[model samples]
Target: MTSIKIEHVVHEKCRIGESPVWEEKEETLLFVDITGQKVCRWNPKTNQVVSVSVDAPIGSVALRKSGGYVVALGTRFASLNWEDHSTSTIATVDEDKPNNRFNDGKVDPQGRFFAGTMSQEIRPAVVERNQGSLFTLFANHSVVKNFDQVDISNGLDWSLDHKTFFYIDSLSYAVDAFDYDVNTAKISNRRHLYKLEKDEGIPDGMCTDAEGKLWVACYSGGRVIRIDPETGKRIQTVKFPVDNTTSCCFGGKDYSEMYVTTATNGMDEAKLAQQPQAGGIFKITGLGVNGIPPYSFAG
Candidate 1:
């Protein structure tokens, strides 16, 4: 186990802060406030924050190789120009299932955009009958259905070798590993690599370090745990002040710093008062590790 220190860096009070990605080229962190329908950028060096509003709920965002960002907005995928806040639709998913919306996603090593959907009506007592699905969008604007009947499709990333694909279906309470073909961007041989106990909380988002350890954000657990994918054991744990810790990514010049996002969507006034930093971005340092550079969307 390693000791870590967590600090609150942003006080935006986002409704649903998620998708923390570090843009090394810009030397800043990018994230989305889903319910607020805004994309934000934070520069740690200057302590400056910039936000851009979108038309609909923005689930996740990925950097584009050319410039700007590719975002999953509500039921459609669009390209966003950060300068003018202008958006152009690229493709739409699950047009028939109005109850479903895009959730967590990332760009693959091959430069393909892979995002998943979830029911908008998620609750503790009510189980949503509307199943979610995952889709892959190519540079040519062609979309492919990868998997279906998914419940709250969440975190996703490839192993250090880019041969094993890891994904999380939050409702399933497990981290699944799949055989990945980088050349074709195809995944198969799916199997459960680790399952979490209910008390550990649900896994929301994840990323891999250069050493092949998987870092998972434990939603209700108020912590981020690093797991040994091959052994299915937790190697390190970094605690946060907020309970709804949503997602995390490594940033900074050396990638030693960790950025985390949390949510305040379902909290009432009392709960919000107890957790004032619920929706703020957190920074963790002294982990003594670095992460691989994030892949960008080629399209």
Candidate 2:
């Protein structure tokens, strides 16, 4: 197995940087600053950086097929107006449960938006166990609860063949898979695909290559791992110096380069002094695996 090195590309130390979606049409990298409550776009071609603040903490973002983006705004899923930074909620969940917020999210091949939720307060815990749920945004603009009891839902990706889903329960340090139904947008046959020991750090955001291998980010491990989901075998481990790698995705013209995002949210001053490049974007080239294009919002 070959290891990859990371080069610091963005300077801002995001509290938490996750969910990266490559917008092919715009040729831009779209991501979210969760604790910063904003959506950011990076244009490498012009060295342009644009960020727009939202009312609530934004979790994840996905490009829409209809020409906009679907945003997870803590408690709701909405459509964003890139021009004015305006948002309109497409669906809301647990309106009565104010202590929950949306976490990780992605669009399936069928164009449905799937997002997960988590309790807001880590201490003085907001909700009882089993409250967090995975939700689906339908064509009629309605939200349906798909599953529950998720703890800090993080990475989410589907296999290239569209037959399997890979997800991470960050707090559990485990990666799981489910038999995915592309047509019905249902997931079943849940099975444990991989698990990270506490020493390896929590599993965060992830993506799948064209070969169907899953590339998962190690939140506190400071590395990204490429694994064979079927056999649960680790094929490669890409290391980063910092200890807060948040998420990664395959981008670039050929989709062979892996773009990674990191965070410095909970780092101590001493640790920050040692790894100053903790919260920055990175790119690793020459990885043999290629990523499939992300699905656009069809609504």
Candidate 3:
């Protein structure tokens, strides 16, 4: 087994830090503070952190080929000029469900952006269930509904061959797979890849390594588990000091380093004192594994 060490990335911290992405060109890390309404960039080399404020709660962000970012802004999909903090709408949904907002998201191999919505009532548990849906935003400025009846739609990644898509709906407490058609950007053959036991916390955002192993963040379980998706078995577990490990992604010059985000949401003063680093960014290394670069939105 490989050894690992975790370190804290000191910053002002976030109320709920999530959705970490690596910008290869700049050699910097990008992430979002869901409830804090900002997207931040951290440079490990200079130890500099900068951020831009968004009007609404920013769920996630992916780099856009068109010279900006595509973000999940509350009830709409919008283009954000991170440099100037300007935004324009791409598409909107969940008008009927006033309490719904976009959650976790990513760009697929085809350059299409995929993001999901969930009820805003989520705290310790899902207050409203099955009211969320997964949405796709194409470069042509068109929106399509892929699936619905989802609660707290989160964590998404594709396989090495681009033939399989992995997803997680937090309430389900499991990782699921779908047969993917990269050219058409369609997914099918839905099946349960693996389910976490009750002791394991709800699964949140996840990423896959170059070796195709799934690394899942356990929200209340205080650890990230590496699973071999093919065998549907657990391979390793990396514990965290905080219980709210929200999301993770692989980055760094060679994609060998892992960056993780945590949250302070729903934690009381007493709970916060115990895990003082709950809302800070974390870096893990020495895993002896490498990861893939995130796809950018073609639009």
Candidate 4:
């Protein structure tokens, strides 16, 4: 195993920091503080951090090829102005389920935004209810329903070849692979590629490296584990200083650096005191791997 050093890069004290994305063109890292209702940009080169406040809880954001960003604000997909932080509605989702909100999402290789919703009530006992679902928003501002009955739709990425789509529904404790159509943005033939035990922790956000291996952040396990998608076995583990590791993405000049985001949402005062770095962003180097560039929304 290769040892790596993890350092805190941002100390925003976010309530729920998630959706870390690397913008290779600008050499900046973009992520969201869901409960804090803010979108943040961190530029390591200049050591600067900029935040834009949003009206509602923001689940995720994707760079737009057209000039700004496509954001998942609460239950609506909206266009966000990078300079003014103004948002215009593009489409709304899951309006019938008022208690549900968008959780985690990413842009596909073909330029479509994929996101999923989860129940806001946070009831772990009632896993039987299908309160969440997965969706895809295309360049035309059209939305499509992909799957239903999802408890907590989190983490999504596609293989290098764009043939397989990997996803996580946190409550299932498993990573699923689906047959994908890059041209049509359709997914099918779902199968479980990996399943984590109770002690291993539930999978949250994920990204694929150059080798096609998946690096998954464990929500309660306080670590990011690299898994070999082909065999569904663990390859490496990167432990963090906090217990609520939310998401991670590979960035840096050569895409060798891994940036991770953590949360302090459910921790008590005692627990928060123990993990002072919780809700901050972290960077990990010396992993001996590179990540593919993140895709931007075409519209």
Give all candidates' CA lDDT scores: 0.88, 0.83, 0.90, 0.90
Residues 33-79 of candidate 1 have per-residue lDDT tens digits of 98799999998888998999988888899999999999999988899
Give the distance in Å from residue 149's predicted Cα in candidate 1 to where it truly belongs. 0.6
lDDT of model number 1: 0.88
lDDT of 2 at 34: 88
RMSD versus native structure for model 4: 1.6
Worst 10 residues of 4 by lDDT: 121-130
Worst 10 residues of 3 by lDDT: 118-127
Better of 1 and 3 by TM-score: 3
Give me the runs in candidate 4 sitting further than 4 Å from their true place: 123-128
**Model 3 regions lying over 4 Å from their true place:** none
* Model 1 regions lying over 4 Å from their true place: 1-3, 122-127
Return whichever of 2 and 3 wins on lDDT: 3
Worst 10 residues of 2 by lDDT: 121-130
